[model samples]
Target chain A: MSSLAVGCRLRVAVLVLALLGAGAVGGGSTAHAADDGELTLDSIVNNVIVGHAEDGNYLNFDPFATVELPRIMVARTADGALTVDLYGSTKGLLKDGTYGLVPHSEGEGGHEEVITESSALQEAFASKAHLHGDIVRTSGHVVADLSITRHLIFGLLAMGIVLAIFLVLAQRYKRGVGRTEAPHGVLQNMMEVMVVFIRDEVAKPNIQGEKWRTFLPYLLSAFFFILMANILGLVPYAGAATSNIAVTGVLAVMTFVIGLLYGSKDHYKHMFLGPPDAPWPIRVILVPIELIGTVMRHLALAIRLFANMMGGSLIIFSLIGLVFIMNVLFGEAMAFGTSIISIGFTVFILLLKLLVAFIQAYVFTILSALFIGISVEEHEHEEHADDAHAEAPTSQTSGALSDRLDAVDDAVDDVTEPAPA
Target chain B: MTEVIAQSLVQPDVGLIFWKTIAFLIFLFLLYRYGWGPITEAMESREEEIESSIQRAEEALAEAKEIQSENKKARREAEREAQRILREARESAEELREEEMAKTRDRIQQMQEQAQAEIEREKQAALQELRDEVADLAIEAASKVVRDDLDGERQRKLVNDFIDDLPKN
Candidate 1:
């Protein structure tokens, strides 16, 4: 018990130190709200929260170091032909002079792109003036702005890492490492444990037997992909791709589409016809409610993951931003004192954020599998019952909880493999 | 659109969604084909192999037990057969010994009876002879008393003729 407490304290101290260091590095160049001398609420909102979470062109490591990625877009040219424009970076696109940035005349969403005459596009950005809005080559008619942004790169990195890891693992198994022989070393063992856990624990109980195998690939992909993205978000400069609603929304949509595609005949019946014994008057109200509920649940599945991930970064930033707010309110001495509390809360939130990272990934995956599970579920009726009697109706994700017992039995008999009881 | 990037964090931007869709689909496809599919297949096959191996082991154990029991039964039968053969042989030997002793006793009794009959015949012959000899001696003594008068030859001849007619004894 004492050791556990010490371990917790040690983690908190490490988190506090790491966040303080990050804050110190990020303090000087928040960019947007530096208009005023002090760190204001506007700075916290514009620079700290938005800047960390936004899908921008430049990969902002710190204010000092930023890497600009390529911009790609498709636009309808004035000649009435579709053209794809590519740039080395946003700077290259502006330098090309075919496109220029104008604050959206609509006044809200930042910048819009319009054609320029010369190779030296918008003369203002020709040199450099806060030109961070993704400007693609367009005649004020950008059909598709597929610009490679910071979040995309990090998202790809997370995905690439997943691919790299799994490819190697797959190859190892292909060579009969985990297949014929015992999975050796930490990497293989750890991953096999994770894969098996996802299969038995996440996929099995939530989705019934045999059916789980059909969706196993999708479920495993979502689980590990989200997990990888979430973990990447915890890294100091790397942000979570799942924090973006667009990304999570796309993921959720994938689930929605899969459920729609593979949903059973019974599932459609349940969706269209709400309940068996309802009066038509009540059924009229309930049917819409049920439909909306199904749609909302999936949508919430997306938003929940986005919100949890985004909320963590937001809270962490806000917690640390309080230090500066306190500095201006009181004095330098009070600011130093506030730093202690700021660091404390930031440490706690950071740890919670770490936990939430894994949790949100799990929640998103399980919820997705559940939605698909239900959509494909054969409704057990008095007439046509489900044949899967081995797995119970309301079984929870506790099947893998007995792996230790199976492992013990496995030792007693090598042939009796470690399948959960 | 001053905060275009800013709003993208919350709003589902069409451009970002397009890219996200492309990226996620590719990621999902690649992962399923290379990683998820093969991994699950390998694990499932391994589990099946293990299950079959366990079944075979159980079958083998049961067969061995059956063979062991069968061997024990066969051994017991062989022992019983040997004991039966030994007892029969002993019983036959005792009967043969009893029969041989009875046959030997009957033979001995028959031989004794034959010998006794022969002995009686010999005794009768001897008595006849004695009688003849006595009669011949008296005749001889009377003849001697009458001064050898006796027709000795005639007396012998008559005794011989009388013996031949009386008994082919």
Candidate 2:
């Protein structure tokens, strides 16, 4: 574990360097370093948004933008709160006068106007503190009446492409070309390795026969999807879409649903009423606890992914902010050292982030498989154990009965032998 | 701003952005139809191709093995043929040697027979000469003994007895 951690640290260093390099280019080109006092998620997200902003020229009323649409604007207020402003005009009627803020999540008329002047406007904007956004949004008549957060969209697209590539490679392997020797095509070969790795390393150990294959698709897809999303988020300007609680929650729920549906009768019964093997008193006490544990596990999956992504982003954001803060204290002379240190640490963290991204994905998939395995395990093993135990007593009784019979027969033989020949 | 917020608050509805859903669906549909299907089919076909190729390769290998076996059989047969020819030649050579040996034996037997016959003829000739000599001697002796007595009749009687006792040549 120490060696692994060291290696992980090295990787993190390299990753940080690469991310910093990317950030440097991005920051140098399209972003401005925050003035001395600013260091927050809101600022970073805002920088990313500002970097990707257009002059609002590409605006169209089409829900799905006609042409390639730029990313939405992300900005921060003076107090480090995040704002997501949809600033483009479309062909629709302009509802222009400055409007006050309202909290949509809360009921409309029941409470006081939650949308206060700056305060309510802030609610519309997601808080940088809690990763909330005060989103200024608009709708248009497009192919799809939805314009998702650019980060989510990118993540989705990336997932789709990655999935497609994997599927294609899988197809090629099935065709049976270059199988006898080593795999021929690079992608095909790599994919074969990955598939085997997931199946053996993740699925087979946890999941048993027929059911393993049945659940393999969902598990593999989820793992790959999360991985793609994570990597995409790592890219500057690309959002780590999985960081969104809703997305992760959905994925966790899917795992939960699968665990519920395909699970064995025993698993279901045990989940609610404890395992049949448990003592009567224990069963009464443990069933509810077990049920809660199941819920908590799935909930943990969601939180783990969400927290890890958000955490990585925050670290990187804070480190980069270190550069500007140092510039304020020691001027340009100390700025370079601070930049180097920031970049150095960032590079390391970034690498760990990469590993974390993959590890998390693996964990999610493996856990999903484990749940599936528990649900689908054959009852025969337990039954066999019971049978063996039962057989011991039966054999003993049968042996005693046979011995007694043999003794009686011997006695009869002795009596008959004397009068025989 | 308050009006805008209030209005949004009043209409706090999150509609399933139909266009977005449609777009996503289309994307999904395309992927399902074009991407996944082709990929899966390609895999299946690739598998089939590989399987057939392996089968064909196995078949070819089997054919090669068969041909090799046939060649081996033919080679063995050819070796047997050479062995048979060699054996036949050896047998013929043996037969010729036997015949020559028999002829040489016969020739020797003939020569021995000739020598034996010559020896027998010489002995018979010699015996004849001896008999002649004996006869002359007997006659001379008889003439000398019966010189004064009836010598002619007695000598004639002796000759007749000798002639009766002697074998014809």
| Docking quality (DockQ) for each candidate | 0.24, 0.10
Candidate 2: interface RMSD equals 11.2
lDDT tens readout by residue for model 2, A157-233: 76677667865654554554534344576776666566567767877777766567666666766777778888876
Model 2 RMSD in angstroms: 18.1
Candidate fnat values, all = 0.62, 0.07
In order, the B-chain TM-scores come to 0.61, 0.48
lDDT of 1: 0.69
Top candidate on TM-score is 1
Candidate 1: give the clashing pairs.
A97-A121, A104-B1, A109-B1, A109-B4, A110-B1, A110-B2, A110-B3, A111-B1
- What would the TM-score be for candidate 2 when compared with the true structure? 0.56
Error of 2 at A320 (Å): 1.4
Query: Can you write out model 1's per-residue Cα lDDT over A1-421, one digit (the tens) per residue?
Result: 1334323322322332244454443333333333455564344444655567777777876757767778787888877788888888876776676776643332333435554545434554433333444454445467887878767777888889999999988888899876777778999888888788888877887675579888888888888888888888878888888888888999899999999999988677756875544557887887888789778877987887787777677666656665764454444786788778877977876777766666666667767777787778764453334443433432222223224324433432342111100
What TM value does model 1 have? Answer: 0.66
* Candidate 2: share of reference interface contacts reproduced: 0.07
lDDT of 2 at A232: 71
What's model 2's lDDT at B9? Answer: 15
